[model samples]
Target: MDVDTEINELGISNTVDEIHGAHRIGQFERLKTSHTGRETLKRLGYHLHDTMHATTHEIPDWISRALKAPIPKNMNPTLHYGRRLDRCLNI
Candidate 1:
């Protein structure tokens, strides 16, 4: 949630992370036409895969709605984690 739009020269949204290395899941329609945009996203996937040692398999189309991305979902780890905590507390 701390991410802000910075002036980008190479990729869409031009995020600070893209400047440094990490790319984001930006506008899907734009990425379809932009080579640099695809590179940015591909790089992020490679790095994440290298760190995790697993392929994503395939991103479901529904994931596009989670636009708070690169932040909110990672912060939670999994929805099940939250559910477990709530169950423990009988909430």
Candidate 2:
């Protein structure tokens, strides 16, 4: 039998749809994580230094809110993390 016939006989056509659906869900999850993970990582203070190096100038609004400070006029907004962390550590 052909592939379609074999798949139908095995009642596995739904499996293909399920796999595609799972892939779409995974894509959405990855997008969400990529967008939100930075803020989450910063909040927990796990790897602030590394993240500062990796981040760009386009600071997301959520990050500013999370940091409870406005983004500076400089190109590298992430540099502010040092002073922010210092204040937090001092308190």
Candidate 3:
């Protein structure tokens, strides 16, 4: 699917969709706008986004980590997601 469609379906912010190409949207519940919520979203988003271009070694590591993590019930959008995208890619 296209970025816009994926963004809409995943409930990501338009700003995140703006990152364009090679990205997966991560969402959190709007009601849980606390530190924990943001942190969890960041980790999930980093994992999802990294999948688009992860190297062979990186892919397995990320997948393993994500598989061990719990699925959150909320669906909220945050502005800092993109800002941390680079850090995730570097990991």
lDDT of 1 by residue, 1-91 (tens): 2234233333457446665553334464355445565566577673323342333466666876664445654465575797778887995
Among all candidates shown, the one with the greatest lDDT: 2
Which 10 consecutive residues of model 3 have the lowest summed lDDT?
Answer: 22-31
Q: Which tens-of-lDDT digit does each residue in 39-85 have in candidate 2?
A: 66557564544534444598799987788555557647476889877
Query: Per-residue lDDT for 25 in model 1?
Result: 44
Clashing pairs in 3: 28-74, 28-75, 28-76, 29-74, 29-75, 29-76
TM-score of every model versus the real structure = 0.20, 0.27, 0.18
Which residue pairs show backbone clashes in model 1? none
* Separate clash counts for every candidate: 0, 0, 6
Report every candidate's CA lDDT.
0.53, 0.66, 0.53
Mind giving the per-residue lDDT tens digits that candidate 3 earns over 1-91?
Answer: 8978888888666564476432432233441345565556666663324433324445677778777655454423354677567767989
Provide the lDDT at 2 for model 3.
90
Between candidates 1 and 2, the one scoring higher on lDDT is 2
Which parts of model 1 have CA positions greater than 4 angstroms off?
1-26, 46-91
* Model 1 CA lDDT for position 90: 98
Alpha carbon deviation, residue 43, candidate 3 (Å)? 0.3
Pick the winner on TM-score between candidates 1 and 3.
1
